[model samples]
Target: MSHDNKTAAYFGARDLPDVIDYVGEFGAELVTFLPFVYWLYRAGQLGDRKVSTYRGMRPLYFFLSDDQLIEKDEPRRFVGYQKRTDPSIWGFIPNPNELIATRNAYEAFPNYRKQFQSTRFSFDKPLLVVHNKFNREWNSDTPVNFFSIDQLEQMFSRLKGYYQIVYLRHGRSGSVDGYSPDHNSLIDFDETSVMQRHPEVIDFEQHHREYGGGVAINQYKNELYAACHHFISVQGGGAHQCALFSGSLLLILHKRGPEAVHAYSNGFYQYATNPAPVCMIAFNDRQLQDGLGAFTDASLCQGRVMLGANGSRIANDLAPSRVQRKGQPVFGTDRTPEPGDVGVHF
Candidate 1:
C-alpha cells in the first residue's frame, strides 16, 4: 500500500499490484484480480512476443526498445489481430498508487466531476472494490461473442439492479447472435423471449457499436454519475476506479468456479459487518444479476455515493491519450495468463 522510494516507476506498463490500499493514500479500497481468459486473448494477440512476458507481468521493455517503433515490426495475427503501435505518443508506465491518484484526479474535473455533493456519503461508510479473478477453459474454443444460450440467459439475469455493468467483448462478434452492427446494448445480447421480457430497456446500440464503444461507455458514466447511484462490475481495475471516484459505491462481482461458490460468497458478503460500509458480491452462479438487489440494498443502508472526487482525479491524469489508444494493439496475442501471473479461475 505504501510506495516509498523502493517502488520503481515506468511508462506503458499494466503490472500494478493485485491489491491496492486506497484508504490512507486516497480514502478508498480498490483491488484487482487478473482475468486469465482476457490475458490469453491479449497475449495471443501479441503472437510471437506471447512467450516473453505473461499478461504484462514483467516490465515491457519492448516499448522502450522500439521507442514507439511498433509500426515498423508488424507482428503476425492470432484470430485477425496484429500488434502495432503509434510512436508519436509516449505510453504510460502505471504505478498502482499513481494510477489510483491519477484516476482520482481525472474524475475531479469540472466538466466531469460529481459524487462529492455531501448527499452521497453516510456517517460510517466503507467503500469496497472486490477484484474477482477468473480462469479460462483451455479446451473450449468459444468466441466472446458467441455465449451459449444458457450462459447468455444467466449473464443477463444475474446483473439486475446494479447501476453500471461492463462487459469486455474482445472483438470476434460471432456468438449466440452474430455481432450485428445494430446490436450494442445488453439487450442486444438478449434474443427471443429474453429481449421480449425487457421491452422497456432502450436499445442504445446504433451509437454504441463504434470502434471505441467501451471507452465511450466509461466516458458516459463519468457524466451519468452525477445523478445515478453505484457502479458494479465483473471487470475490475480502472473501471472499478472510475466507479469509486464518481462517488458511487464500488461493487466488485468476482467470478469463481461453481465449486468456489462458498468461498466467493463469504469472501465478499462477510465484509458487510466491517467498520466501513463496504460489501463484496461474489458468485459462481452463471446468473450474476441474482444478487444485484443485495448490492443496492447495502449501498442504500450505507448512504454512500457510488463514486468520489478521486475518480475525477483519474479521469484527468490518465487521459485517453496518455494510455493505450483505441483500436490499437498494446500487447501480444496470447489471451491466457502465464504460470506466474495472478488471475481468477471460475
Candidate 2:
C-alpha cells in the first residue's frame, strides 16, 4: 500500500476516524493540524468539517471561529498517538512522507502572520516575547532543552534596552485551561530570583494575573504575540507559536527533537508562516551565544540583518551603520556608551 494508505490504516487500527486528526500536544497542533485545517477552510472543503483539539486551543483557531467555518469544535480525547510515535498520523494534509520530500506549507498555506496580527495591544518599545519550558520529558531527571537562569539573564541584559522583554514559564498553579501543569510534567525554575535580578523584564504569569481576564489564556497569548515581531523560545509549543508569526525573527534554542532533523534537513522550520519568519536554531550554548549576537546586531543595525541557522548572514540589504549613541543606555546600564562603544559588527 502507499504511504497515505498506510497512514489511514494506522489511524483506523487505533479506532480514530480518518477525517478526524488527533494531536494532544500543542506543538504538533500548531506545526501540523492547524495549518491543515486552514488549508481545508481556504479551499472551501470545510463546509461541514469539524476539529477535535484541547479545550483552551480555541483561540489558536480564531480565524475559523471568526468565520464560523467548521461545523463543530470537539474536545480532544485520544492520546494514543504522538508525533514521536508516528508523524504520519499527526495531520490530514502534508503527510509526513511527502513533507519529508517537499516542504510546501510555506507556499501552500495562508499567511498566518497576517491572519493573527492584533490591533488590540500596542507596546512602547519593540516587544520581545521570551518563552521557556521546564518539564520532565524523554524520561530525563530534570528538564531538557530549556533555558537556564544564567542564559536568560544574559539574554535580558543584552536586549533589555531595545526591547520590552516578557518572560513566560508556565508553573503548576494559575495555568489556563487545557494547559494545566497536570497535563504536562512540571519542574520548578527560579523564576522569582530571575525577576528579582531583572526588574525591568515583565513576568507573563504576573501580566496574565493583572490583565488576562474573561478570555482564555491562549487567546490572551495570541493577542500579545500578534503585536510582537521578535521572539526567543526553547523547543516545543512555545517555539512553534513564535514560528507562526511572519516578518519576524525567532531565535530558538533547541537541543534535540524530531524538529531538529526537520529544521536542518527538510526545511520544516519555514512551513508555519507565509513570508516565512527568519528562524535561527541553535544546537548548543556556543550556537546560542552566536544567535543571540546576531539578534543583538540586528537591533543595532536597525533590523537590516537576517541570520540563518548557523549564525551566518543570509540576508543583508543595507549598509552597516555605527551604533546609535542617543538610545537607552547600552545593556541596561546607567552610563551611555560613546560612538563605536557598542558592537554593531556581526
How many residue pairs collide in each prediction? 72, 0
RMSD of 1: 15.8
**By TM-score, how accurate is candidate 2?**
0.73
lDDT of 1 by residue, 65-97 (tens): 232112211221112011111111111112222
Worst 10 contiguous positions by lDDT, candidate 2: 316-325
Give one digit per residue, the lDDT tens place, for model 2 in 197-275. Answer: 8899988777876877766677778778777778888877778677667667777776654444334224445655555
Model 2 CA deviation exceeding 4 Å by range: 5-21, 65-93, 96-101, 104-110, 172-183, 299-346
What's the TM-score of every candidate structure?
Answer: 0.35, 0.73
Clashing pairs in 2: none
lDDT for 186 (candidate 1): 22
